[model samples]
Target: MQDAIYAPHWNRNAHSVICVLRGRAQVQVVDDFGQTVFDDELQQEQILTVPQNFAVVKRASNEGFEWVDFKTNDRAQISPLAGRTSALRAIPADVLANAFQLRQEDVSELKVNMERQGNTLLRPSRSSSQWRAIA
Candidate 1:
């Protein structure tokens, strides 16, 4: 959908080969070290391959976004990082605070914000048109 944002997630057991079928999108993939591995704008007919456990997020253009995500497995299990049903929701606030060196209340507030954004795919906010790629 137009302006929609796919939440950051990584497959637990499969690699994904994504082919953009319609519109355009801003895609960002992150490595384990929290460094961005790939970040660029994908236009119609473009394709992107994301390895297992490599977090990926996408924001749709105003024209809307559509794609076919081919996974290695018949049913790929995904773990979302931003959402109400995300892994962050399962961890104790104190644990998260300790791990991030943040206050427990701050961690709690962060979780609340995630919930407010809606689970998984988020609603449209702003349209992005700039194009940049980082290796």
Candidate 2:
């Protein structure tokens, strides 16, 4: 299997937990409608939890990134209680672009990087509207 990389964003109604499987990841979980809550770099096999809404996670560029996401919903098989939560939110392109340390040239390079490492698991060209609903 290959690693997955993505931009992170926050949502008020969703909560998610990410567990690293192989490589490194960067995460920022914030509950504030206007402030930074938590920020750090997570190495291999680390686990992070987002209790409230508005959290962001981005896979580091220099390291291979692989992780599993456990999304939550009230009607799902594993529902979260009052203090628990679940859901996935789309990270805006502008916000995502800001978090990464790359120029326009890197976009093509990112694909090259993935292709060389056999990590092209996500089809970024597809419309977000057609993607599966994860929560």
Clash pairs of candidate 1? none
* lDDT at 19, model 2: 82
Q: Distance from true position, residue 53, model 1, in Å?
A: 0.7
- RMSD values for the candidates in order, in angstroms, are 6.6, 10.9
- Candidate 2 TM-score, true structure as reference: 0.47
Task: Please provide, for model 1 over 1-135, each residue's C-alpha lDDT reduced to its tens digit, 9 standing for 90 to 100.
Answer: 767788789998999999999999999999878789999999899999999989999988989899999999998998888776688878888889999898877787778776665466666334443222211
Q: Lowest-scoring 10 consecutive residues by lDDT in candidate 2? A: 80-89
| Candidate 2 per-residue lDDT over residues 1-135, each given as its tens digit | 212335344434546677887767566665556466777888778887776455464645355677776666543232211111321113333443566654645434443443344221232224532211111
Q: Name the top lDDT candidate.
A: 1
Query: What global local distance difference test value does model 1 have?
Result: 0.82
Question: Which lDDT values do the candidates have, in the order given?
Answer: 0.82, 0.48
Error of 1 at 114 (Å): 5.0
Error (Å) of candidate 2 at residue 7 is 2.0
